[model samples]
Structure formats: C-alpha cells, structure tokens
Target: MAIQRILAEETVSVTEMRKHPTDFFTDHPIAILNKNQTAGYMVGKELFETMVDLIRQLQPQESFTATFQPSVTHLKAVTKGSAEFLVKANKEELGDFVE
Candidate 1:
C-alpha cells in the first residue's frame, strides 16, 4: 500500500478562525493537511506512523494535525518540511511529488 500527502502553506490570521490557532503563534509558515488525496487508496496504518515520525524528525518545533481516512486506512497531516523530509527519508515516496 502507498500513502500520499500534500503540503500547503497558508497565512491564517486570527480573524480567520473563531479561536486562536496556536498558543503563542507567529505569522510564519504553516502546514495544511489534506485527506481528499488519501481517499480510496490502499495505504496501511504503519505508513501513517512512519510519516508522522519522519515529519516530527524534520521539524521539531512545528505543530501537526492529522485527519484519518477510513476509506483508505491512511492518515494525512499538515506539517512543516514534509516534502524535504519525505524526499530524504524515501525518495520513491516523493516520486515527482515535490517540485
């Protein structure tokens, strides 16, 4: 099974959300998780765990959010430096996904 992740960076202001997005936050780079890409894929649970570990290893200070995909047995998260870490961890997993 192959798991996929897409990372998007956006500047979200306090007005965008009803509550504060972070405890002590700044307007720096933020990761946005997408589960739509994981739908209908035959990914495994271990793949998700591997991704989480790899992501945390890359950006220790960043916050990550995950959305489970019941349709595919996978999870997606919005985290910093995912593309760079994925390329270093598993080049094949990146497989032209990173630009």
Candidate 2:
C-alpha cells in the first residue's frame, strides 16, 4: 500500500463526522480522511468566506468599461484589456423580480 500524506494540522474520519457533524467546525481547516487517505479539507463558513476574500484581494484589479444590455437582464463589462466579465443587474434594474 502507498503512503498517504495529509497536509492539515487536524484530521477527522468520515465516521466521526457522521456521528457528530457539528463537532468538526473550527477556525482552521480540517483534513477529512477516508480509508486512511486524504479526502478534503473542511473549514468554518466564516473561515471559508475569509479565504475567498483573501484570494480576491491577491488577484490584480483591472479597469473595466461597463455596457448595459437593452433588456436589463444582463450587463457585460469589458476590461481595458481583452478580458470580459458579466455582472448581475442591480435590484432597481432587475425590477420587482428581485424584491
């Protein structure tokens, strides 16, 4: 059998999680193991959100030009470069559907 390496500081088995699902939430990520193999890491909702925010902060920001669609359902914005992104319509633009 090959040796499995786990990078997490804490490890929990699937059986334990099934026994007590709420017991595993922590400020740090926990590595979930299956059959003594690394499966995935689980983190608290707040921690996961913070990680996502940190990732977004690390990415370079780009200047973009906004263009609204006639139907108000979609808005496409193009960066100063060749990149393009789609933004959801605002509440007012989306009208009663959002509220």
Candidate 3:
C-alpha cells in the first residue's frame, strides 16, 4: 500500500511534468528532465541521511523505531530495513525487514 502511494505520487509529478512544456529551460526539454530527475534523487537521498542521523541522535542507546509522514513532494518512505514499522496506504502493508 505504501509503495503504491509512493508510485502514485511519482506518477502525479510526472503527469505535471508532462503538462509543462519543456520550453522554459531555454527550450531544452532534455535538460529540464535531467535537472528534475537529479533534483528529486538528491532530495530523497538527503532526506534519508537526515532521518538516519536524527534516529541515531534521539535513540542512541536503543533500537530506533518510528513511522513518520514526510513532507516529500513525491517520494515515499526509505527504510533501512526495519520489520517493525508497517506503512499503509494503497493495498499493501509490509513488515519491517527481518534479518
């Protein structure tokens, strides 16, 4: 379910991207696409890093566990393999990673 939501959000963003003609970036559609993709990728990676840091600091002495709704424009949860957190949205709910 969570994955579906995330994908849906990504789809919506892509749809919006389609609506906006690639003419603003000096009429370079390819450049605009590449820039958007890079921006999204970097933002997701940065968010994951920040969350990991926060969890380490706030729960340094114990195992960290929590579910949060991020203010992400498109991407959804990025788990470091936790089996205890269950995210629900579309029709799928997965347990934390079990190792």
Candidate 4:
C-alpha cells in the first residue's frame, strides 16, 4: 500500500502505542506493505527502532518487548487524527513507491 494510503487507513502512533502497547501489537503486527498493498512482511529492525523511540518517550526508564500492544481506543484516536501518526523512511526504504 502506498504510505499515504496506509496513513489514511490505519492509525498507528507513538502515544497510542505507549498508552496500550499490548493491545496495539495484538491487533497490528509490525509489517511493511508494498505500494500495491498486496504483499507485506513482518518487520524487525525497522519496527524495533521506531518502537524503541516511542517507548523511551513515554517511559524513559522502562524497558519494552516486541509483544506490546495498545488499546483499541488509542488506535482509533490515532486514525482519527487526535494524535500524530508518522512513518519515516528514506528513498531506499520506500522502494515500493519508486515506480
């Protein structure tokens, strides 16, 4: 899926994740989607980096694991634009958008 479309359709934000990490992960596994939205794979390093930043922001001294999830409400809030949803990638990372 196009990054823009993903941002438009699904809501994922640091605040939401921080609020209900467990629920969020349960509902949304970390994945990278192609521009066509047809294929996606589980993300590791990239997702880990993003989550680390989020966790640190919310709980500086707390350690987090990949199993965390966020609440449904928090997810909705992100999609609705109550919180900022960001997806950062360089041109190389965004190979799906090249064409």
Candidate 5:
C-alpha cells in the first residue's frame, strides 16, 4: 500500500462530485479522490486566483521579471544576454486585467 498526502481540508469522492457538482464547492479547496486515491483538487474561483497571486509573489526576483504591470511586459531570460524590465503593479488589484 502506498501513502498519499491530502492537501485540502475537505475530501470529495469522484462519484459524489459527479452526482452533485455544486455541493462540493464552498470557496475552499477540496481534494478530489478516485478509488480512495488522490486525483486532484476542486478549487473555487477566488481560491484559485489567490493561489496564482501567491505563486507570482513567491517567484524569485533575480531569476525572472514579474508579470503584472501593463506598460512593462516581463519576459523570461531566454538567452545568456537576454534582459527583463519590470514595472510595478498594484498588488491589491489582483485578478483584474490591465487597462
């Protein structure tokens, strides 16, 4: 038998999820299971967006430029001499597109 980690506080079987999809979502992350094994997570829209924002913040500043500013586009350092310019964006206005 193999042990698996459950990342979410709630667990929902695939069968139950299929039977009632909306019942599983409650603005919190839920672990989706298949045959007692972990399959994936059922995350609400708000939670998903929050996760994305956290990921962006956790990214190494020296490695790559941040991608949030409208005027400044951040690109990956492709070549040895490739460079990146970062423009500050309002962290409060996450999940919103730039004008």
Candidate 6:
C-alpha cells in the first residue's frame, strides 16, 4: 500500500474513535499510542528547532547525525557554516514524498 493510504487509514480509525467516545474508552491503549504518534507528527518542526538550538548551546565536541526530511531550507538555517554539524541530504531515503 502507498504511504498516503496507510496514513489515511490510521487517520480514519482515530476519527472514528472521536466520533464514538465509548469506542475510544474501550480501546484506550490503542488510542493512547495513536495520540502519542500523532503528537510527534504535530510537533515535528518545533522539536527539530528545539533540538538544534540545544545542540548549539551545548556545543558538544562529538559528531552526531540528525536525520530529517530531505528539505534543505531548515537544515541550512540550523547548520549553515557550522563546523560542528554537517547536514547531508540522501534523496533515496526520501521515499515517494520527494518533489
């Protein structure tokens, strides 16, 4: 199945739970897991920015990898001319979402 189709199905399941509160309660564990996953997707941008800011402040000497979507704009903003972190784009890892 396509990634978009899989995401849409997950979204539909969540929406069904919201429409039926009793079902949400019955499937509370699944709901919680779904909520956590959704929350990550919602805060992805903010999370990335905060992580980059913290890394900058700490200025760790060790090299690390921060993987993100193959978009250059935010990566450039975070690692532009930075000797500590190097931003690399792997288009093959982008899947079908790449433009």
lDDT of 5 at 19: 97
Error of 3 at 6 (Å): 15
- Supply candidate 1's per-residue lDDT for 81: 57
Which is the leading candidate under lDDT? 5
Model 6 weakest 10-residue run by lDDT: 3-12
Q: Write the per-residue lDDT of candidate 6 for residues 1-99, one digit (tens) a residue.
A: 333212212232444555764543321123222533442122234555776789787876686667767678877876775523323545564446433
**C-alpha root-mean-square deviation, candidate 5:** 14.1
TM-score for each candidate, following the candidate numbering: 0.22, 0.56, 0.22, 0.21, 0.57, 0.21
Using TM-score as the measure, name the better of candidate 3 and candidate 6: 3
Worst ten in a row by lDDT for model 1: 34-43
Per-residue accuracy of model 2 over 1-99 as CA lDDT, tens digit each: 877777779999988878987778778889898888888888888898999888778777883435844543332323422232114556575567622
What local lDDT does model 2 show for residue 14?
Answer: 86
- Candidate 4 TM-score, C-alpha based: 0.21
Off by over 4 Å in 4: 1-3, 7-9, 27-99
Q: Where is model 5 more than 4 Å wrong at Cα?
A: 62-99
Which of the two, 2 or 5, has more TM-score? 5
Candidate 5: 10-residue stretch with minimal lDDT: 78-87
State the lDDT of candidate 4 residue by residue for 7-99, as single tens digits. 323444554445664554433354334434523333345566787688788974665556758899988887766323225556676677643
Candidate 2, run of 10 with poorest lDDT? 77-86
The lDDT for every candidate, in the order shown, is 0.45, 0.73, 0.39, 0.51, 0.76, 0.45
Q: What's the C-alpha lDDT at position 91 in model 2?
A: 58
Ranking by lDDT: 5, 2, 4, 1, 6, 3
Better of 2 and 6 by TM-score: 2
